[model samples]
Target: MIRTATPADVPAVHALIRELAAYEKAPQEARATEEQLREALFGERPAVFAHVAVDDVSGETVGFALWFLNFSTWRGVHGIYLEDLYVSPGARGGGHGRALLTGLAWICVERGYERLEWSVLDWNEPAIGFYEALGARPQDGWTGYRLTDGALAALGGSGH
Candidate 1:
């Protein structure tokens, strides 16, 4: 039961984000507010698109995957950058994760996207295995970088 998420799903989405952060041992960093999520996701220019997996009988969201389109200059085709994917602890290993991945793959194929990409923490070996089993491989030569609030401010002040 996977479907696109709507504005009405913000609360549940926010809760899932918090849960994922907690699972990654960074609960305090899960500070996304409902208003922020709503505006970013459903605004005139959406920041990302979300797909949620719901339990058939319970009608509760069990997992979700958020993604945005990115261009691969080298490949000369669009790609899907998977920002996040989380399945509730109780619902894991119940095919939800695989279903979500399958749904994302379908989106890629249907839209003619050349690639689908995501990152998993080095400590999460199980996730690595899961992704590998799904035929996803790590881009060996790449490293991820980020700029947070203070760093972003400093960079802005530097004025290049």
Candidate 2:
């Protein structure tokens, strides 16, 4: 079952995040702490939201979807920007991932949002196939970019 993550679910979700990072071959980049996640997800005026998927038999939180709002200039509507979605390896064939995504899609449709989007690593062919099976297509012409670490600081004119 998929449901909104409560504060009690933070640690489990945090672990799931580590698993995701490892799978993505970037374990070193999973630096956010549990306290940071708690504050981000449950703080006053929260800027992020999360949902967890529970195992039917074990009742364990086996998956999670963390997201935030993004505004589309062309559509003039706020859409969900999924930051991460992960399901435990043992739970892969149980549809947890699809259920998590379906929940987000429901939110978009219910709120009249024009888009539900997230980026997938180019080398993760299994994930690409899964998303395609769900009727999700790549935004072919657009390239994703980010400025972080020294580049981000330098651009902001702040020496780190």
Candidate 3:
């Protein structure tokens, strides 16, 4: 069963994040703390949301989808930008990933949003196949870029 995550789920979600980072071969990059996640997901004016997939028999959280809203200037609607989607290795192939995505898609359709989007690593063939099987097409012409660490600070602190 998939349900909205609560404050109590922060630890599980944080662990899942580290697990995902390891799967992505960059455990060191999953630097977020539970406190940060708690604030982001349960703060007074929260900007992010999370949903978890629970095991029916064990009542354990097996997967999670963390997302946030993004405004599309062209579409003029707010769409969901999924930040992370992960299912525990032991719990995969049990439909948890699909359920999590379906839940997010339901939200978009219910709210009249034009898109539900997320990025997957180019080399993750398994994930790529899964997404393709779900009718998700890659935005081929676009290359995603990030400005972070020293560069982000330098630009942000610049007066220009």
Candidate 4:
């Protein structure tokens, strides 16, 4: 079953995040704290939204997907930007990942969004194939970039 996540789901969500980080070989970079997650996901003003997939009989969380809205200048519509999608190793091959993606796609269509986008590491061939099988194509011409911490500070100071 897939449903919107609540504050009560934070612990399980964090556990899955850690599992995903470890699988991606960067466990140490999963620095999110309970307080931060709570504030961002359940506080008065939400920064993002999440959906959890639960086992029907066991009632255990098997996977989750977190996302936020983004505007596409070219399409002139707001679409979902998937931040993370993690499924426990034990739950692999169970269709949970496809279920999560389907749910998100339904949300996009229901809301009239023009697109949904996410990035997969180049080395994660399994994930790349899974996404391709779902009819998603890689944005061949675009490269993602980010500025963090000191870079952000410098940019802020530069006022440009």
1 against 3, candidate with superior lDDT: 3
For candidate 1, the TM-score is 0.96
* Candidate 3 residue-wise lDDT at 128: 94
Q: What TM-score does each of the candidates earn?
A: 0.96, 0.97, 0.98, 0.95
Per-residue CA lDDT of candidate 4, range 2-117, in tens?
A: 89999999999988988999999999989998788878899998979999999888999999999999999999999999999988978878888999999999999999998889
Task: After superposing candidate 2 on the true structure, give the runs of residues whose Cα lies further than 4 Å from its correct spot.
Answer: 158-160
Of candidate 4, the 10-residue stretch with the lowest lDDT total is: 86-95
Candidate 3 clashes: the total is 0
Score candidate 2 by lDDT.
0.96
For residue 140, give model 3's deviation from the true position in Å: 0.9
Q: Candidate 1 on 39-99: residue-level lDDT in tens?
A: 8899999979999989988999988998899999998989899999999989988889899
- Full candidate order by lDDT, most accurate first: 3, 2, 4, 1
lDDT of 3 by residue, 5-81 (tens): 99999999999999999999999888999999999999989999999999999999999999999999999999999
Distance from true position, residue 116, model 2, in Å? 0.2
Cα lDDT listed for each candidate: 0.91, 0.96, 0.97, 0.92
- Among these predicted structures, which one has the highest TM-score? 3
User: After superposing candidate 4, which stretches have Cα over 4 Å from the reference?
Assistant: none
Clashes of each: 0, 0, 0, 0
lDDT, residue 72, model 2: 99
Count backbone overlaps in model 1: 0
